[model samples]
Structures are given as structure tokens and as C-alpha cells.
Target chain A: MTCTAKKCGIHFQPPSIILIYEDQNQEKTRKRIMPIRNFSKFSDCSRAAEQLKNNPRHKAYLESVSLRQLQKLYSLLKGHLKGQSLAQSLEQVQREEAIDPEEDMNKLDDKELAKRKSIMDELFEKNRKKKDDPDFVYNVEVVFPQDEQVESCGWDAESDEGF
Target chain B: MAAAGGDARAELDVDVDVDAGPGQEKYDAEENVKIICLGDSAVGKSKLMERFLLDGYRPQQLSTFALTLYKHAASVDGKRVLVDFWDTAGQERFQSMHPSYYHKAHACIMVFDVQRKVTYKNLSNWYKELREFRPEIPCIVVANKIDADMKMTQKSFNFARKFNLPFYFVSAADGTNVVKLFSDAIKLAVAYKQNSGDFMDEVMRELENFDLQQKGEDFSDKEESCPEEKPPST
Candidate 1:
């Protein structure tokens, strides 16, 4: 019952997520058309992706597909509904996922902050080495490079104003 | 690849097109005409669509999106036209539909339960929202559940007359006027898409003109009048 997902794409007209997969048991390549209902340009891509992946009908086939990939597909569909071109949607997704260390996330709105946090969570999950990984090590240590001087912050400076 | 072909046709803005070759006349639709159904919850919106598209009436409730899409293939004057009938899927209970539901829509079928006077009164609000997004498309006011009271059909409804839109008294349970209502809607949608001076259509036409010029095909000669199909009497 092993299924290998080969490709995933979006259908804009009726708004469906099309998945091409190989069913090893049947030895056949099949396409699964999951109709995206109730989705609008303002829909949250991550929530939509989670729903599609957890759907009883599609859950089995989508088990091999990553949630991040599904979210990207939904994001592309959302962009198209908002009258954006394919290239524009891809660039937008890339920009959202790319984190800037200098950016102050505390200034972001709740929804924007949640989006950034989810992006960080996905990135951390991807880079994490699990116990089952070939490169897994019981104990690993690395030396810190302190070549650059640290900048002092106002909060870290002791002052008579602090209680 | 099939999905890509559908998307390409959507871009071309050719909603109804005749298939190639003589005598090979099974019309295959190249583009889709989106028709949205708006009404209050429990007003038989889904039932009417179910009755019209009797076969393959698989209604997927993607509650997250708050809409259900009913896909039906119909032929208008020998040209195959794929129609997507959008149902509210109870989104109306929240007092509004997502603006995307009206985005690029060709026509609208606003329904109300004949048994409920409140449903009838709410037509104005639904029509207002619909016009805010789509100002020029053809909209039909439907009085559904006519089977409950046939006398309702005899009673005049001023909403449709006031708006100058076509009206239909349909019964999803008995299938009265169901087929005619849907078929006529499809025709109106196709007509709107062909005649309306939408901005997207204008851009698509310019693109098509460039391709036609390179291929040496006369685009002007392809303009054919819409067939005047008589609406079957209910």
C-alpha cells in the first residue's frame, strides 16, 4: 500500500489540487484530483493544506507528500485567485518563507507573526537530525566562533533608572 | 497535462468552442463558464443543482472554503461549454459569501425558498452584494420549493421584475422547471462571456489577435451569433 508522490499542481478554473502518484501495490501511476472547496483568495494556505492532508479521502495518498509542499500549492492557487501571475505567486511564497535576522518580528501583527513562526518551525523540523538518521550522533559539540565584538543594548546596561 | 490544458483554455477566454474536423462532432469543452448560486441556508440551492445535474452529482463540502462546486458539461448551439455551478455550501449562514465566489463569474442564480417569506425578502441583500462585485452580469431570481405550494407560482413576485432579470419558479423535489432553469442559465452565462466587454476578455482577445495574425487566420470571420434556443415551457 506504499504510494510515492511524484508531482503536485493546482487547477485554477475549478480550483483543485492535482497530485500525480505511483501506487507500488498496483504498479500503476495515477492522478488524484482533490477539489478545493470554499477556498478564496484570502484563505490561509497552511490551514487549507492541513485540511487537505487530513481529509479521509486524500489522507492516505497524501501521506507521502510534505505539508509544506501542499501549502505552496495552495498559496499558488490563492495568488491566482487574487489575479497574480504564476511567477509572482512563486516569488511571494519564497519571500514569505525567507527569514530576515535583522527584522523585528515583535512589531508584526498576530497573523503575520504566526506565519513567520510556522515558517521557522518547518525549517527547524527539516534541519533537525533524528535518532533514525544516518548522521545521528549521541554526543556532538561545536566550538563557538567569537571573532566579532558584541553590540551592547540599552536594556543590558545597568542604570539608576532600573529598580 | 489535462489540468494545464484546462488552465490554458481559461486564459484564452474562449468559453464555448466547436471541436475540429467534420462529422467528428462530439463537442469537447475547452473552457469553463462559472455560474454562482447565492441564497440563504436551507433554501434548496444544493438540491436544485443536484436535481439539474442528476448524474455525477458529487457535492464536496470543502467547509474550509465554504463553497461546493457542481461541474456540468453542456452544449450550447453545437459548441461544448463546461459550466461550473458554485453553491454557497451554507456560507450564507454567516451572513455573507466570500468575494472570490463572485470573482470572474459569468452569471448568478439567486434563489429563495417559496415557503419562507424571509428568504424572499433577503433577495435584495444578496442582489446588492452580487452587484457590488459583479455589476453587469445576467442574474436570475429563482423561487424554489414550488412543489410545496403551487399557488406561489401564480402569485407575482416583484423582485425579479423590479431588477429586470429573468425569473423561475423551480421545485427541486418534483424536478419541475429544474432542467429548463439550469439550461437557460448556462445559455445566459455563455452569452454574457461572449458579449460582455470584460477587461480580462479584452486582454485575452489582444493576445489571441497576435497569435491569429502569426498563423494567418482571420479572427473577424469567427464571430458567430449566439443560437436563439427556446426555453422549454414549465
Candidate 2:
């Protein structure tokens, strides 16, 4: 399968579900193939897919690699359940498009670029002054903490050299 | 044996379709088992999973940063089992894994490169992380990249012995012990599911919570933010 990226055009095998089973009476193992349904058909991908395809920013970053991964994950999730729940879970991880700093470069018009530059300059000026203000403090941490039920484990010890 | 069957019956109160015909029905043995792979970057953990699942298909290393779930079916002792191989990004950044990734995992395969002494040294840290969340789940220690010139056979054996976890010397590139490792994992998972009384309950609870999260009804503040931002080092 060719990647969805128009520029990349890399040929890659799309992920699919293949079930290998054994006949109870027979000794040889057999296989059954299952079609991987399109991700867009699922209810959850509707909004995310639209955003992924229509937005040039997203398309640029999503790339063929990410698109393939997304499809593979979606197929695995959808294969297990008939409900729309898997779609919802996927939408959770579908991140918003980043605000590109070079967005103005795409427009060939000079006036538009100048206008964007002015806005950017104003925001940059505000950012610089805000950091120097004595009243402003970056207090994202909590003073008091309670013990929470969280589990983390590791091996007993480490060896730099193989024994 | 009857008691074991009875226990299994109670635990499997899943809403599996009952009306599907005999051959058409998804067999009880055909249940989905989630198996997680943990190892240092480039220990061939992903390759091992890909080789086992695709069975002779070698995929180009995409070097995924986040967790990627690969689904495949295996016939173990006349039972068809759907295995979900969760290939984690790497072990150096254990902080990336959400606690839920370990929830209800039927089995684990912790891998290390035979040539890289550093990867083998980090195995204990991986074990500790896994045991913290899943204290009782069966884990296997695999010495991967056996095709490499540097062989640590005895050391790998000793490490496996220390944890009492089954060990396999595998070469994912050449397809050595890859099949055995996966089949053994599936068997261990099936046995673990049969024996663990609350295993299914935990899985069900996690599944429900997953559905709730999908619906935006999850009120828990502890949800992982910025999940999988750091990709595994190539």
C-alpha cells in the first residue's frame, strides 16, 4: 500500500488481521484472513479524520508514518468490539494541530505577511516583558502532597558487565 | 478440574455473542490476551513481536515512540487465542508508560540485547517497574539479538534464575526461538487467566474505565498528560 502522503509516495504494507487456527481433527494449522475496515467508516474518526485531511498543518506533520500507525491502532481497537467505544478512545489521543510560526510564509501576498509579522512582534514583546516582572511567579507546583496509590517497580540491581 | 472449570465460568461473565453458530462462534480459547514487551531501545523487542505476529514478514523498523498494539491469532493446544502484543517504546523512559498499560496484562516479555551489557544491566529496573504495577503476572526474560557476536548465555541464565522467570535466548533477526517465546507466553497467559480468580474482573474493570474515558465521562484527575511525547532513541 502506498502511503497517504502525496510527496512521500512510499510503498508500505498496510496492517491487517489474520487469524490462524488449527482444525481439531486435522494436524495441520490453517489460516483465515479478515479484512481491515477503513478507519473513516468508524464513528469516532469522523471529526478527527476531517481535521487530519483538511488542515494543511496537520497533513504536513501527520505524515505517512503517523497515518499508518493510526490506522493500525484503529484496526486493532475496532476488531475487538462492535460498539463505537474504540473510536472515542482514539479521539482522546488525537492531538490538536500546532500553531505554525511560518503560517504566514504560505501566503504569497506581502501585505498579509507584514500584518502577521506585526502581530507576532507584539506577542513577542509582551512575552519578553512578562518574564521580567517581579509580580509574576511560575507557581505550577503544589506545596502540600498526599500519598497516592501508584505502583512502580524495577529489577533488584544492575550489572555493567555481563556475568 | 471441575472446580477450575467452575471458577473459569464465573470469571468469564463477558458479553460474548451466544448466538453465533458452532464453527462461527468465537471460541473460548480464542479470547484476547494482552502481552506487553519491555526492553531497552534497539534490543529487538519490536522486531521480536513483529516476527512472531507476522510470521516471516519483516517490517521496516518504524521506531515507534509510543505504544503500538499488534494483534495476531495463535493456536495453542487446539485453542485459538488472539494475542495483543503491546510493544512499548523503551525501558529507559519508563515514566512514559501509563499505569493502566500494566493493568490486566496476562504476561510480559522483558527483552535485553546479548551484545549490549547496558541493556542487560537495565533489566532489573524494568522488572521492578513491571512488578510494582503487576506483582503476580508471569514475566519472561528473553536474551535477544543472539545472532550478535557477543554471547551472554550463562549471564542471561543467571539473571533469569534470580527472578525465577522463564528465559529464552532468541535472535529476532534470524527467527531463532521467536516462535517458542511467543507460544510459551500465550500458554503462560492462558494458564494465568485460568488460575487468577480476579484477573478477568480487573480486565473488565479496566475495559469499562477505558470506555468511560472515551466518552469523556472519566472524572479522574490522574489521567496521564502529554502521553508518549518522547520517542525511543534510535
Candidate 3:
């Protein structure tokens, strides 16, 4: 359908009529269903792309990705540490020192911390192969500008321009 | 124009006074019931809602360019219920819906064009998508475009029956069972809300038991704390 704008009477075609199932005489029905093209074209794709790119969900998804990575790292580190609290662990180390002064608790703690860090690094390295996997689908949905918010984006309301 | 109206309502933030006349108090309060429409493209999901809301069908008019909201006040079970029908233009080509679209949805209407077997085949996909968000919400299956020659067969009825959902064969063109379908949808939504309140009570009882168990308290203590679930005298 042609936009009602007097000066810019550009024609915009709606998405093609999709008929997955129909009667046996499909050719006649197809001809009847198709809309006639009047005007040549209108360029709106670049602007639509820009709008899609700058959607808040895009930014939120990016932020969520990093946050999720950090969370996974935190969990892995916790697992490696055997659920020990710093204070309780320090107390245990002091008690161990009392039993045997020659064995350095600080050295043991540092060694343990390094071991956990290495384990986390190795896990990250192992999963890095799946990073580029085509099957790995991200849980993200495209968020359009709200109807109220879309008004400020130069979208002509009546004709549904810049869709 | 719809966007402007929606924006104006958003800005007001107060209950819209829909009562224009004296006896309109029967339809007073703004109890919002959100109903989402889902289906394959060209299945008349938009047309069905448009017909229901406007009481007229515009064949050439594509009512949904974006998420369109239709607000109608219905006197459901003696209560004024402002039902918000959200028409998500079935195809997710340019923009996929944010999770917020299903947020607080009270009911769903899954439409499929009876003429098109593919649309009928995609019913489960739509139902699954709806359940992912609003699991407990009541869903009604609608076989739209029944006016078309190649209508849905007995198998369609069985499909809806399998899910134990209310199903209706509707025609947006001739307005066959359209009004009753929407009215029934509202009634079902009201009933769902009522049942959900009771469902919450059941949840609270379970939560209280869990809390008591966590605290190492006796089961008898629930009788003292959860007075709401107290047995009645026979």
C-alpha cells in the first residue's frame, strides 16, 4: 500500500502472503492473493537495523554475558576451595601450626589458592572450543522500541513507517 | 493514534474514568486482565482481536505493525474488568518479543487458520512458548478463518481436547462465535484470578511447612502460626 503522505507518496509492500497449505488449484488462488505493486520502493532497512542494534536488550545481553562468565568463574573457584571460609581456614592453619611449626601454613594456603586458579584456567581453556559452536544458542530476544517510545524515532504512526 | 492514546493513559497513571454516564457504575473499577494472542502469520490473530474489539472486520487493514493493545471494559461476573488484549503480530521477523510481553498475562488465545494445515501443525509450538512464560494461565485454542472452504477437521478438535483446553471455531469475516469467544475468554480470566488466590494459599501452606522444618519446629506449631488454614467446626 502507498503511504498517504502527499509529498512522499512512497509505496511500501507488506510481507508476501504466505500460504503453506491450499486447495489443489493453487495457481489461481496464488494469483488472486498477491497484491499489485504500485510504487517502486522506500528505503528504511538501515534505520531499522540501527534501531535493532541500539535496542536496550542488546546492551543488556552483552552485560549479562560478562556477568554470567564471572558468576561461573566464582562457582568454579568456590568448588576448588572445598567450601572453606577464610577465618575458619586460618584457625585450622593456626591449629595445624601448633601441631607442626616447620610446615608453613601461609605457603600451603598460597599453593592451594594457585591450584584453584589453575583449575579454573584449565576449565576455561577446555570450554573455549565450544565458544564458536554453531549449535550454542544464546538466550536472547530482540526487543522493539515501545509504541510510546517509537514516536520519538521519526516513525510516521499512521502508515507504520520505518517498521 | 492508538500509540497516542496508550501514551496518554501511561502519563495519567490514574485509573481511567470510563464511566461517562450515571448508570455506568456497574463498569467502574479498572481491573486489568492481560490476554495475549499467539498464532502463525496470516492466521487472522490480529483480525480476530480487531473484530472482537471493534465489532467490525477490515479485510485490508493490518491492525498490528507492533504490539497493539486493545482496552475494553467488560462487566464480568458483576465486576468491571478492563481487559487488555495484546496483539503480537504473529511473525517474529524483525523483532523477537521481550520476555516482558508475557509478564502478568492472565490468559492466552492461540489461533490457527483452519484452511492452512501448517498453521494447525504449529499449534503445539505456540502453546509451548506460552507455557514457558505463563504456565498456570488459562489458554483457549481458536480455529480462525473457519469461513474459508478448507476448514479444520475433527482432528483439530481432538488436538485441543488433548490439552483439555476450551476450543472454538471462529470466523472473523462473518463474526461467527466471535463475541461469545471473547466474552468467555474474559470470564475464564476472571475465574483464573479467583482460583489463583486459592492457589497462593496452598503455596503459603507448603512454604510454612518448609519454614517450620528449617527451624526444627514441630508440625503442631503450624496450627498456632498458620491460623488462616485453621479447620472449621463441623
lDDT of 3 by residue, A11-111 (tens): 11341211122224333222112221221224232233333234464332222122223223222323325555545644553442232212221223444
Q: Give all candidates' CA lDDT scores.
A: 0.69, 0.52, 0.48
What TM-score against the true fold does each predicted structure earn? 0.45, 0.43, 0.41
Across the candidates, what are chain A's individual TM-scores? Answer: 0.72, 0.20, 0.16
lDDT of 2 by residue, B1-234 (tens): 112223544533534432221111121232657688887655667767766655433223224334566666677788777666667643235433555466567889988766555566667767876765566778998877655542333332456766678877776655567778888898998788677655444554475578778989754533233223212222
- The CAPRI quality class of candidate 1 comes to incorrect
The digit string of per-residue lDDT tens for model 3 on B1-234 reads 112222433422334332221212221123656677887555667666766666332222224334565667689768777676767643333223434455556788888766555556566667766665556778998876555442232332445656789877776655567777888889887777666643322443465577788988676443435433221211
Share of native interface contacts present in candidate 1: 0.00
How well is each residue in B57-96 modelled by candidate 1, as lDDT tens digits? 6565656677786767689999877677789865676677
Top candidate on lDDT is: 1
Q: How large is the interface RMSD of candidate 2?
A: 24.0
Model 3 residue runs over 4 Å out of place are A1-163, B1-30, B55-65, B94-96, B150-156, B197-234
Scored against the true structure, residue A160 in model 1 reaches a CA lDDT of 16
Model 1 DockQ reads 0.01
Q: How would the candidate models be sorted by lDDT, starting from the highest?
A: 1, 2, 3
Error of 3 at B64 (Å): 13
Pairs in steric clash, model 3: none
Cα deviation of A156, candidate 2, in Å: 10
